[model samples]
Target chain A: MRLAILGIGPVCALGSGIQSLRTGLQGKVRPNIEEKIIPTSHGEKMLPVYQPVAEGLDRFIPKRALRRVDPFTQIALLSTYLAIEDAGIAFNDKSRVGVVFGSGYGPTRTTFKFLDNIIDDGDIGASPTHFANSVHNAPASQVSIFLGLTGPCSTITCFEHTLSNVLVTAWDWLNQDVVDYVLVGLGDEYCDVLGFAAVGMNAGRTKDMQPMNFNACTFLPGEGHITFLIAKDKSHQEGYAKISEIRMRRDLEEVKASISNDPVIINASGNLQQGKSFLKVQQKQLKSYSNLYGGFPTSSAFDLAVGCVSMKDRKIYPVPESQKKEVKLENSIICLEFCREDEFNIYKLE
Target chain B: MSLELDLKKLIIEELKIEDVEPEDIGDEDALFGEGLGLDSLDAVELVVILKKHYKIDLEDMEKARAAFASIKALAAYIRENSEVQ
Candidate 1:
């Protein structure tokens, strides 16, 4: 199942919308890496993290409406609003538009707050709002409730597999004619626990990421939400890119053999090609924007966003100005995201 | 702070009733619908707030409807309940 990306709504360290994304990808603007202090088992530790917290949410949704909503749900709502605005469609029937959201972590801060309520005042003193927002599907529920979207909605929490699952799910839903359009979302948040863990994990301050060197875990924790409004027909708005095929393979040779020709490897192969000499020796134009958007498990959504934008702009924007490459319209971009030594997902876009 | 004022702040802060300041809520204004526009979720939060801050454990809102009628009423109810408890 394939769907055309009608609109892109991404909120990250680089900023919101495709313009900000394109600017950051072109290396025109640099996202400042801020320091966050988190209390861990070994006391508190300060670490570098990317806090792309959703801003000015009151502009889209009423402030009162967001009273019980947590930060995780707030970003999901904001990104959904952005995707809808980017599409610029006057829907005849909003109930037919389905929503699918994916996340690496769902409201860890809220969950911990609920736990605090339990600790401070015991089990009976737990807060109702905190308890309600602590679930993994709370964001998706909030989005549908606030927007009054009556269509089929779901949330997937699969860590690194979140982005691919979200896209593939939306693709299937649209192709199966279950809905006219599918609004897909992928997000991960940086809370206090994740912050100290990233610090203890030795997330280095390497300003750039070496895509080929998988051993160097120089990824700082980042938080953001990237959404796409996709449909079978893109006559409503200008499309960013069309998803042709998405495949998930658990074998190294199978994944490698699938992309034997010149493929636009979106991000690093990581553990997907263990001992695969062809992938290591192949002369491919590897591009990674990890410097712009920091590192989270589902950052590949940002990669896909960049790929779609690159295809739209007819130029691939590398992190530094030196790695600039012009992309042709006819070239098919294969975004390879690896999960484990023998597990990977491929997204082919033109 | 007066019990009325403190309850108003809790209602706004914990109940998350936005665009309205503590002083904006009148002493005689209703805490639920039409007066302050609080809903069932806000009712649940108010119950927790009472339990957490006032040490007044409410088993349910069925018996507290009159006390929650207004901020003044709620304050008087709390004072009366504090003495009894």
Candidate 2:
């Protein structure tokens, strides 16, 4: 089903909402982490961290509700609230609304706390509340609970492709008429021990590991939540962009063939002809925006945000690539592709 | 045991900095952009960590920013505001 983006909200190092984020993207500054906690011996040094801009939580969150949720959940709920508000949808009738959350790592603090208690004071020390909040689906569940959503609720954790995975899932939900509106998001919170441990375990396996452990230029642990409301009808508030299409492919050649047929190719490689000859037939603009956003899992969320803003501004901010100065946008034609392990590829054309 | 030393240890523990001990973090060192090396994100995360550890809530950014400047500063802030007598 075709879905229109009604509203968008994000908390990142770039700042909050669309405008600050737009400026951040255009500037292409690597987010600084500077988190104090470093290894006592042999571990990664933290660098640029993704922090949420402290807006008045009381403005959107109830005092009683905030008492029970973790900081990550609070960020997710706030962003979700902003999406609903931007969509101009009344929260009273939520039976028609669905929620989907994407996370590379779910609520690390909650999980960490639970583990700490279990190790320190035995299983009896584990708090039931913390245990409940530690699940992968807790973020999405919290959204439903806070918004009173009775519709379908789901969560997707596909490592780096989390946002894209959720996007595809949300697109399906909208197309099948499962729900008239859907709130989709991705949230990741930093856990110092977990972050270091992940890199330590995966160090030899992955090429793009966190840098030197202390610089934000590398993978410093970050916490951020971005929410979008998708509906059949266009949103009342100014929408940043809309989903053109979302497709997942198990084969790269199949994706290449499909991309060759698309009208726009926003390849991460900066080579427009990187797809296929069929796509190469046209004099389509080839550009990259990686330098702007500094490649992350939910970077697509930023890309989608950029696409939305580009639609509004009528200009595509070009990444520093080759002889190409910039990619101009006469109309809103954007294609997003995410590939993992060369075995799976997901393409979304909007 | 000085409360400031304990606070530094807690910061190191909560932030999961395995390399440093309470002695590494000076009582008057800057937490961000210098001495202790924390950013705005760490400041926010520290809010929850402090609440859990010391039972103190630092909500305002200005206050959080100031308290986070150094282990000593954070300890002083905690001592002044903590309800436990």
Candidate 3:
């Protein structure tokens, strides 16, 4: 599949867009913090969530449609616009380009609010406005509407593997000459219930978490939105990253066996089993980026953003807290696990 | 049988509290920390619930947060402030 990445935009806990992510990844900084408690019965008191600055976004998204879309969807819409602008693609281009998005906790928070209104008050009391925006496919739908695109609009809700799935699917469409371009997007947001349930669920298993399971904390309740513009035979100037090779598998052993040489594995968690397995394989040197990126399901999207930036700059950053280990940098492969059983994605960035 | 009982039932239903009936919820017990396990979001939902069911417009967030302590408290607050038609 010859899909060229024209531009990438990301809004996460760290900051807004690709530059914020790049700075975060490069500096080994941790951006997780407790925000104000939301008004919900859900357990999250001070939830760790990512919210983007509202500056410069109004120029990209329209006002009428913006009224309905939530922050996450708004971020998605903004990223799409930025990606199109970054790609130098004109909105007037009437080509049938599709938008494929991956979301881990798709519209759950919004749906939950609607559920509250329905269960608490009567159905008539439920906010028709909120109810309309609760669909899982809302981001893509809004993107389609924003661009007035009459093309294939798809949404994926497969935990963290969303980006790989969307990219591969988009790649397939491009490979088959089904579409000229695909706007691959990823978005996840924090709701009080989700954040509380996350900590509650984590506490149930790990019981004695003193250091507070930093990896899980980063993910359980953070909000992030990112988008990449992939074009066929359409390579354009200085600020672009190519989607080199995206592969997913059923288990981690396949990843271990598949990774050829010194690679950067952005393990979602600091799990010893997966960490040790990478060490045992001896395929190549492994540098961890998870500590900096945190542990969100779509966190790999952030790491992918970093990798894309690295390819453009020709540099590999060390693990955030590597402690002056004098680690050598090399052309690295990115490996990750979507879940315990599911072998995540391994991106070979050039 | 009373407005308080009715409010209690509505809270449990709204908050998705399983296994507990309206009669079981104590009037003076805490609704948030250590009592009914309701959090801030649930409190917001409760405020919306009251406004819709009882025509009580709880514009004050602080007062609503306090009312969410328990069914008894919420019922009293509702009785005092509700604009029932």
Candidate with best DockQ: 1
lDDT of 3 by residue, A207-237 (tens): 2211113343233345668898877644444
Model 3: CA > 4 A from native: A28-32, A35-54, A62-65, A203-220, A233-239, A250-253, A270-284, A291-293, A323-332, B1-82
DockQ-based CAPRI category assigned to the predicted complex of candidate 3 = incorrect
DockQ-better candidate, 2 vs 3: 3
Which whole-number lDDT from 0 to 100 does residue A331 have in model 1? 68
User: What TM-score does chain A reach in every model?
Assistant: 0.89, 0.77, 0.82
- Please report, as a residue range, the 10-residue window in candidate 3 chain A with the lowest summed lDDT: A203-212
Query: Which parts of model 1 have CA positions greater than 4 angstroms off?
Result: A204-215, A233-237, A260-283, A320-330, B1-3, B60-63, B77-85
lDDT (10s digit) by residue, model 1, range A49-75: 676746667788888778889888888
Judging by TM-score against the true structure, name the best candidate.
1
Give the lDDT of residue A131 in candidate 3: 66
State residue A198's C-alpha deviation in candidate 1, in Å: 2.0
The model with the greater lDDT, 2 or 3, is 3
State in Å the error of residue A287, model 1: 1.6
TM-score for all models, in order of appearance: 0.87, 0.65, 0.70
Per-residue lDDT of B14-73 in model 2, one digit per residue for the tens? Answer: 555545677777778787886766656556557766666666756687888778777767
Candidate 2 lDDT, A1-350, residue by residue in tens: 45678787766665566555667656644443334344535654543334566354577766654555768887788778766776676756678788998887788889998898668655445555677779889878988887678999999988766876788788778778888888998777777665565345332222222321222222334567788888764545355556656665445465455544333434242212223432322334434343343334555565566666666666666543333334456645545444543433343424
Model 2: CAPRI class? incorrect
- TM-score, candidate number 3: 0.70
Error of 2 at A191 (Å): 1.4
